[model samples]
Target: MSRVIHVFRSPDRFIAGTVGQPGDRTFYLQAIHEKRVVSVMLEKQQVQVLADRVGAMLDEVRKRFGAPIPPPADEFTDTDPLVSPVEPEFRVGTMGLGWDAEAGSVVVELLALTEGEVDESVVLGDAEEGPDALRVFLVPERAREFVARAHSIVSAGRPTCPLCGEPLDPEGHLCIRLNGYRRGVHIDPHEAPDSDDDE
Candidate 1:
């Protein structure tokens, strides 16, 4: 059977959010318009990059097509499990962003990961049979809101150690900058973990 593509045109909602706890989170991109809903899985880094790129895209659009109305408050869904029951449309392999000059929308194209080689059938226009893909078109202002919310979601994750740049649990981390010494860990006289850094 031919693969399906989910498209949300001028979605009423488009946002990036996470599911699960800070250290064990799964990032998701979701859109809703009319009766359609689309959700795709992505990496945390992808969320960050998507947000950053959206900001940049808006800037370019402004310079070229005059400024759009300022976006409303950067608000994402506060409810835990951004998308409940957690079913993903597809695991995103590549996400592409572009502007529709005629329609004045930011087009987000997500390509799914194929099992093997790419579908070369997508040469001129249509695809006869292809892997899953999702597309969402957001107005400039809505795009801005999505970007802001995305940043917030990414930052709400586990804190990073200032020294070694690794995620820090509430108990602290073993910072390589501290020569493999775990910050705030008691070095008991009885059983201290042997470390080459503890010279």
Candidate 2:
């Protein structure tokens, strides 16, 4: 699961982004009008939940802003990360309307990444169920045409990793056939201890 991060201009105006990179997962957001920016670093699943909520808000936003607005230019790289490399569309989530009709401007809520801890190279969760994960309300949709396009644009022309099957990290990687932990190889649990203690 990915994360959902929010950027709110007002109680009614808001947006969200999933938080994750090749290995350095973190949410980056900036609200130009409000003169505010926020970054949330959290685990994968928490972010996914938030995304679901935001998806629900899309309809409301559509009514106000008129059809889900195209993702802002600065939001993504020139080449989508999910395509060419990911092959299958890796749609993380959606952006839609919120049910705050009282304020009247279709509320834009994002299925976003929750707040977490971040470092220079990578963003990580405290534990599987720790507070590090940013909970999103919206879930990833099968058809994420918009997100696919955005990832490509933001990537600035980079390839995805062959091993982990994600976008490559900034430093690049070594391509030697690694032993002990091959993708399809299986070792007995009891035998694993002997190998570790030997070290």
Candidate 3:
């Protein structure tokens, strides 16, 4: 069964589509405005998966930045309302979908970000539960910002890991701490399991 998902959208503009199978990593993203059809295949096979992640990020943004407009009555069932294409305070823009049998490659096009534009290439993550061919990835601007800030923090040569209060070597640190209960691979894999067992 094909599942329809609202990938990214706001009070003014939105993007939504349906995913049918888990074969190709790509699908097609259709944008609607004033009841006109604007179709674009987001060449990447894992678009739906990426869209799911982006949707989650947007939810987080809405929670931290402020709040998302309450879902209108019958928001799910109601017909797509007339909306402007203006970028909203929300952190998502320019949605894409793709499939492999039809499209050859998964392509990502950045539309906007928290500050301005995002030009980094989207990287597909390792496959998970679903079909290997139906992978997903995204290059949200906020994520890039997180990376840039992290890099800045690392290069800034401050003291202690921002996440963990561990001291660093003169050559710099490699994130050996796990503030969010999630440690980097740099930590001893054997130690993680042993530590977890203790907990």
Give the distance in Å from residue 152's predicted Cα in candidate 1 to where it truly belongs: 0.3
Looking at candidate 1, the ten consecutive residues that score lowest on lDDT are: 119-128
For candidate 3, the TM-score is 0.27
State every prediction's TM-score relative to the real structure. 0.80, 0.30, 0.27
Tens-digit lDDT track of model 1 for 82-122? 54665798898767788887878888877787777665454
* Candidate 1 local Cα displacement, residue 193, angstroms: 34
Q: After superposition, how far is residue 140 of candidate 2 from its true place, in Å?
A: 19
Tens digits of per-residue lDDT, candidate 2, 59-157, equal 445656575433323232322122111111112233334343344333333232225433312222222332222222221221132244334333533
- In terms of lDDT, the best-performing candidate is 1
Q: How far is candidate 2 from the true structure (C-alpha RMSD, Å)?
A: 16.3
**Winner by TM-score between candidate 2 and candidate 1:** 1
Of 1 and 2, which scores higher on lDDT?
1
Model 2, CA-based lDDT? 0.35
Task: Give the C-alpha miss distance for residue 150 in model 2, angstroms.
Answer: 6.7
